[model samples]
Target: MALVDVDLALIGYGGATSLLLDALDRHGVRGLRIATVDPVETARPHRTWAFWTGPRDAFDPILDAAWSHVDLYGPGGAQRLELAPMRYAMVRSGPVFARADEAADRLGVQAVRASAAALDDDGTSVTVRDAGGAAIVRAAWALDSRPTAPHRPGRTFWLQHFRGWWVRADRDVFDPSSAILMDFRTPQPAHGVSFGYVLPTGPRTGLIEYTEFSPARLDDAGYETALRSYLKLLDLPELAVEEVEDGAIPMTDAPFARRPSPRVVRLGTAGGATRPSTGYTFSAMRRQAEGIAAALAAGGDPVPPAAYPRRHLWMDAVALRAWDRGLVAAPAFFERLFTRNPPGRVLRFLDGLTSPAEEVALMGSTPLLPMARAAAGDLLARIVR
Candidate 1:
């Protein structure tokens, strides 16, 4: 068969691709032949995407829930931080994907149900193949948002694994106004950190999750055990689980190749959208999508901008190193951070929007000795590498 030609080819129709498609549509960039390759038949499974941003965000239209007050619990006590003018928002994947599909249909973008086999870029055009080694399509430019290269042994890497259950109680047992960002009362792991996250949708319904940042993933049974333990700690009434969601997100300071080739660009987590410390990607992915759309609109090469700010990257590296080396206690570190600094400042820092002075102030809130040691060690490791 003759090779099919398109203006652009998107390998995976996930968060990044959807955002890019949305941006393209908003900019009135239409009538271009585009193809999306993915194996999933329908929309992706039900998962929640959460991020902290100002009161008004581009994604507010699709937000399922938002909380202005977040609670943090540790050995010290509980701290309720008010995020005025900024709120933490959560959007269900089902709705977001449905919206994206609608946009794709309106924009005349084709969806192919096949896994990508190979990608070849030769300056002028890019070609992609299916798993059967058959030519899928050729395009002027292709954005490959497939899974990233595997983490090599000895590389500083961590996995943010989580299992969440949507539960309904027999009676009102949750405060819908406040979300529990972290509850460290649960059993702590030997290494890394573990916490419970709660997002109450109603007085009797909520999503509770057991999340961990560790070198390795936990089994299904392990997660269930932890969830049971957390529920017991909460001492809520009998509950019925309506749904369950599980996922593992990569958290690393390792470099990701943004431009694998002149014509093929990487997107999403593959392009380093995952924040090293918090494992947040949606906001960063949105920023990257906007950048690509702007570049294309300007008739320039659509290479995505840097995934994250340089200073933010440095802070993430240092924090990851500190956690990996067990230089500081996870609960204590977080308690200090939330207790010492204004909630908005900490949230802004986590979102990579804080200025240099704000960042310095945030750093000063933490234990100086451990941070200094971690910074020095990270510097030495980078120098020797």
Candidate 2:
């Protein structure tokens, strides 16, 4: 068969790729054939992603639901706060993916179920291949989001792998209006951070997750044990498990080759959209997709924005260092922050919504000794290298 040609070739169909396709339609970036290739069977089952947003944004239409109040539980107590002028939103992966898929079809983009096997880079054009052989895709630009092996280049890159159980109780046991932000009563790892996350879908339905920010992932037994212990502590024995969701998100500084070539780029977590500290990527991926589409529409560069700014990177470095040194208590630090700071400001900080001054003050809240050392060390490393 003859080779195919397109204006843009997207190599993955995950959140980032889907968002890109949607952006293309929204921005009216036309006159280009696009091909999105992915190994469909590899997509994991549905998982829930929760985020806090201000007003209407690019993805407001797709949000499955929203909550006005979020509750934080720690050693101190429970602090319930309304996310003023903002709402906490949750969207299921299945629906999000389906919506994007339908939008892509409406935009007249070809969707392929095969994966990209290889790439041939020339100065002007980019070529992508599949398992059939060196099948060519002549395109002005090609983007890829296939997973890559972990890179530990003189630094540690941890993952926040978690397994969550969607459970329903015989009686009303959960507070439908409140989403449990974190429960610090859980055991913290010696070298990393660990905590429990609960999002209530209804009075009897919620998802309880066993989360860890460690260099490796937990075994099935480990996750189940932690979740069981948490539930037992909460005295919820009558709850029955209705569904299970699990995922591993990479948190690292391994310089992702975002701009691989003149006509080639990367997007999504594969392009380092995942936060180095929190392992959240959904909203960042949305912003990235919009940027790329806007740039392409105006005959501009299509490289997605670096999800983490310099200040945000520094904040991550400082926090990770403090956690690494065992200087800060996992639950206590978060508890204090949530108790002291307004929910909106704190949520914005977590969502990468703050000025440099605010970011500095946020970092200053950490234990002075360890955080100071980390900041100084980070500066020195930058100077030396």
Candidate 3:
């Protein structure tokens, strides 16, 4: 088998690899030999990644939409939260793929169109064997960003599944200045909860989605019924369905390994970027990519650091435990948080950027006693394990 050597090997180029290449390109890391391995010819899936961040992006050319404020509806009532420093933005995969390709080409990123059959890290270097049993890439460091599935069930697990419809109406039916972060006005599941969110690309059109954080997923008919009912509740004009988007993200407190071996580091969801309480991965994934790329460009160790701090992960574990045990109701829990906390605090907390003082105040907005008990139980379970 022919062996090709590189300075760094990216086992998958779907999302994280693309961003890493983009960051490396922007850094102008000269003469850094990189190989990206993925069997797919194009990773341009019709997906939308939403994240709350500052107003600037290196990929602003492809941004689908951005909102300065968001609306929240819960059992108590409806409220609007203004986002001053941070804006919620959506980016389409097609544009991201295109932009990343441009950057990869400019940075001289070698593309390897092969499925990874095996990875061997021998402490000194890492080797990647393709599905055809060829040792295609050997490098001092490797970033394995292969897409992961939901396995290793945690004590608390939920499927954050959703179906979105991109529709356009004859008249202006959407508000471009703001988006609906969460609308708990939708029907609730017996075991979990249901909500809806709208991202307005324009005043007359946008994508509306019905989402649930439940242990089980709905059948085709069930999802259709729920989404149709939600649309009816909004009382919107008859619109032309332009496209459909759907996917499911696993929200679990299970530990994800960042490094499978000494020289091989994981990235994206495999590296524990997804938040357990809120199925948000884009911001974390981007953050990790930038950090790793920056370190590499500066001639530092490129092994990924923990996506979220230990304290934050512990808090997430406790929150997930409370959610699974029904100690804190999802709808009411979020409602109280948004209503009690100042604007942008909850969003920052979700982004894992909240300070300790902000977190303490945010915790006060919940059922403190019950949450504390849940935290204690989680801690005890971990200790026993």
Model 2 whole-model lDDT (C-alpha atoms): 0.76
TM-score of structure candidate 2: 0.92
Candidates' C-alpha lDDT: 0.86, 0.76, 0.85
Q: In model 2, where is the ten-residue run with the lowest total lDDT?
A: 148-157
lDDT at 116 for candidate 2? 82
Q: Write the per-residue lDDT of candidate 3 for residues 1-385, one digit (tens) a residue.
A: 4677998888887777777777777776768888887888854567889998787877677799988889999998889888887888999887777778988888788888788888889999988997767788899888988866544657787879999889898998888999999999998988888999989899888999999998888988888898788889899878788998888887888877788788888888898889888889988888888888788788887876788877787888888788888898889888988899987898889988899999999999988988999999997988887
How many clashing pairs per prediction, in order?
Answer: 0, 0, 0
- Which should have the higher lDDT, number 2 or number 3? 3
TM per candidate: 0.95, 0.92, 0.96
lDDT of 1 at 50: 90
Ranking by lDDT: 1, 3, 2
TM-score of model number 3 = 0.96
Relative to the unseen true structure, what is the C-alpha lDDT of residue 351 in candidate 1, on a scale of 0 to 100? 72
Q: List the residue pairs that clash in candidate 2.
A: none
The clash tally of candidate 1 reads: 0
For model 1 the TM-score comes to: 0.95
The runs of at least 3 residues in candidate 1 whose Cα sits more than 4 Å from the true structure, single-residue gaps closed, are 150-155
Which regions of candidate 2 fall more than 4 Å away from where they truly are? 41-44, 57-61, 131-133, 149-154, 380-385
